[model samples]
Target: MSGGILSPLDRAIVRATQEGLPLVERPYHAVAEAVGTTPEEVMARMERLLAAGVIRRIGLVPNHYALGYGFNGMTVWDVADEDIAEAGLLVGNLDFVSHCYHRPRHLPHWPYSLFAMIHAKEKAAADALVASIAQLLGPLSRGHLVLFSSRILKKTGLRL
Candidate 1:
């Protein structure tokens, strides 16, 4: 779970994965060479990491803005405490919703606990999606959209 407990090779793999493997015909081989390991070894270690839950997933993150999805909104919902988990699952299942999670509510000032992300072609489309979610969650549920004004500052793998 922690880098300190991982083997040197595993740590190297983690670092490489975070920084991103080289873009080449044989990406694994390129990564292995950088980390002083063989392609087979890198593949094996990755498999082990996945099996052990050290790595949840390995995949690509496309640029939504480049794909014509210019509106990126972080929608936070104020669902009842007892319904947070169910509501999170429901919201996460939506095709437009990219990420959903639960966080502690900030009372008096802020009361949202569940958060979901939506990327759309325009702000109106994003607002429509939020409206649909409101209809599904009812009056107790309240949300606000935070539109991203600039590019994402950070996007990378976990350090460990």
Candidate 2:
């Protein structure tokens, strides 16, 4: 693992996977070719990287909207800094929540510190998920807002 000190080859492997694994019968072989390594070595290195905690997951990222999860809302909250970790863990565990993370507040005008994205087939379902998050946070949340997305302008995850 080298204590997360990635070698040049390790960095190359990470970079190759960033754009996402290639769609092929042997994706690892493709990655190996791109990184100038053998497929077995690539798989072993990836396993080590995973055990080292440098990589959290490697899997498909589906477009839920295409699968009838049309309503997506970003629920933002102004939570006490001390309680955010606990509250965020609870919110992130909800089945409807797709993503959750902490972000810096913009102060006076924009004060949300934690954000959670919920996806559902309808607006009412998304609203119910927001309500569940509100109940979980309870007094820990000073204020919260749910902004339902009207459309998907861009779908790809940012690579740079």
Candidate 3:
């Protein structure tokens, strides 16, 4: 939809921001120069795009590993369906959980309905966080597991 409706300047803005905003005081100014527009105009265009749901997110994505968070575990749980919504909100609000959401379950093989990502500086810390989450879920959880990430993958440019 955006591809067809966006002006050339807007398209350039999308390309320029595909990776991320420049790490500078006036990132929008830099973007304006790249797209041949004024900073205020760029900001206005961005606001319009966001209002139109063309841009979904604009925020800092912290580098946990760089900040001494060495262990990353994607904790998945098989929670009671009726209780998943409440449990997910609880887990998602936890200080130690970076991401928490509900996903579909593939029964007979993979049955995890709740997914939460826990990060820590060490394996023990990550494990402790997982334990806390398990305890929090208690009887509402059917089963759970941790899928540890062994390596960090660089974030490349736009997917499409």
Candidate 4:
């Protein structure tokens, strides 16, 4: 784990990909070229970094708005603690859901514990998607709300 610290070469690799991996047929090769290493080395280091929890994940963060998915909503659900696991799995597996997970409720003001982000083409479609999740959950779902995004937020990964 290197004492949970990033080595110089590892720092360089992270810097090269902090913004995002280069758009290329071989992204690792591009990262290697940028960091003065080889493709295989980059891949190996990345694997080790991931295993050591230095890097949480490496995946695409598509601009949903640009893709015509203008109605982006984060659906929050008030599912009983006992049914959170089942509810999360049911909502998370929906085709339109991009991500879903459980969170601690903040009490009186905020009671939702399950959150799922959904993207759709229109408001009606987004509402329908939420309804579908409610139907799937049935009695397990206490309440829910879809909070639409107001603006785009800059997304980035670890920075060296």
Candidate 5:
């Protein structure tokens, strides 16, 4: 049995796939070949890593821009602290909301705590999505701001 530290092979696997899995039918096999191992071995090791919580998850990161979703809005809400959990769950389940989570509130200048990300082809569509979230939150939402993204940010998973 091994300790908590990652093995060399495990590190190799993480490094190879950290950027992203290959865009192919058999991505794991490609990763295995790159890391000098069999696909089965690579899959088994990845499973172990997931079970141990060494890696949170493995999933595709799509480019919304390429998909014609140019309007990206990060909507921040001033949700009641006690009702944040329920509010977050409700907002997060919406089809338009990509992600929703709680954040620490800064009093006075910045009172918003809950945040949800959304994307659409037009600004109006993005606003409508935000309004739906607001309607869902109801009185639990004190106020909110839909901060549209001005530029694309580098998106990457954890590094080895």
Candidate 6:
């Protein structure tokens, strides 16, 4: 069985995990040094967190826009409730899909529930990708595309 709320140490670990460890070759070791724990302990706690579903994943964010792939879009889908998960899984696996999630749809006016992002080297490429996704989804899916014009804000890391 799992315990109650997170302990202070565990909270610290979570925060550290989000803010990221030092960028050195031995990043975990640096984190351990800052958190006053051993690298092995940090690794063990991270594993436990994963097992407990406290954290889904640890990943690095690449600056795709800076790499000249500035054309990005959020493609929203109005999919059957039962097929949302299946469609999400299928779309999420696409190489161009950077993020995917489900959101509540407002009736009468809005009907999109599943959202996925497609990033490409140009707007035409992104548009074609969205068209391909729509064709792949076929008659069961309905949606629209919203292209990102500018990056107004950006943030990395999280606070526990």
Predicted model with the maximum lDDT: 4
Candidate 1 clashes: the total is 0
Ranking by lDDT: 4, 5, 3, 2, 1, 6
User: What TM-score should be assigned to candidate 3?
Assistant: 0.89
TM-score of 2: 0.75
Each prediction's TM-score versus the true structure: 0.82, 0.75, 0.89, 0.94, 0.94, 0.84
Q: Model 2, poorest ten-residue lDDT window? A: 151-160
Q: Model 3: residues >4 Å from true position, as ranges?
A: 1-4, 156-160
> For residue 54, what is the lDDT in candidate 6?
85
Off by over 4 Å in 1: 1-4, 139-150, 157-160
**Each candidate's root-mean-square deviation in Å?**
2.8, 3.3, 2.1, 1.3, 1.3, 2.4
Report the CA-based lDDT of candidate 6 relative to the real structure.
0.80
Residue 43, candidate 3: alpha-carbon lDDT: 91
* Candidate 5 residue lDDT tens string, 1-160: 1687999999999899888889999999999999999999999999999889887888877788889999999999998899999999899898888888899998888999999999999988988888888899999999999888877878976687
Q: Tens digits of per-residue lDDT for model 1 on 6-97? A: 88899899888876667799989988998999999999998888888887787778788879988888888878998887888888899878
Question: Per-residue lDDT for 25-58 in model 2, tens only?
Answer: 9999999999999999999988988788777777
After superposition, which runs of candidate 5 have C-alpha atoms over 4 Å from their true positions?
Answer: none
Rate residue 80 of model 6 by lDDT.
88
How many clashing residue pairs, candidate 4?
Answer: 0
Residue 41 lDDT (model 1): 96
User: By TM-score, is 1 or 4 better?
Assistant: 4
Candidate lDDT (C-alpha), each: 0.81, 0.87, 0.89, 0.91, 0.90, 0.80
* TM-score ranking of the models: 5, 4, 3, 6, 1, 2
In model 3, what is the error at residue 145, expressed in angstroms? 0.5
Estimate, for each residue in 52-108, the C-alpha lDDT of model 3 and write its tens digit.
Answer: 888877777887889888899999999988999999998999998988999999989
The per-residue C-alpha lDDT of model 1 at residue 121 equals 92
* Clash totals, every prediction: 0, 0, 0, 0, 0, 0
**Per-residue alpha-carbon lDDT of model 4 for 25-108, expressed as tens digits?**
999999999899999999999999988888888899999989999999999999999999999889888888999999999999
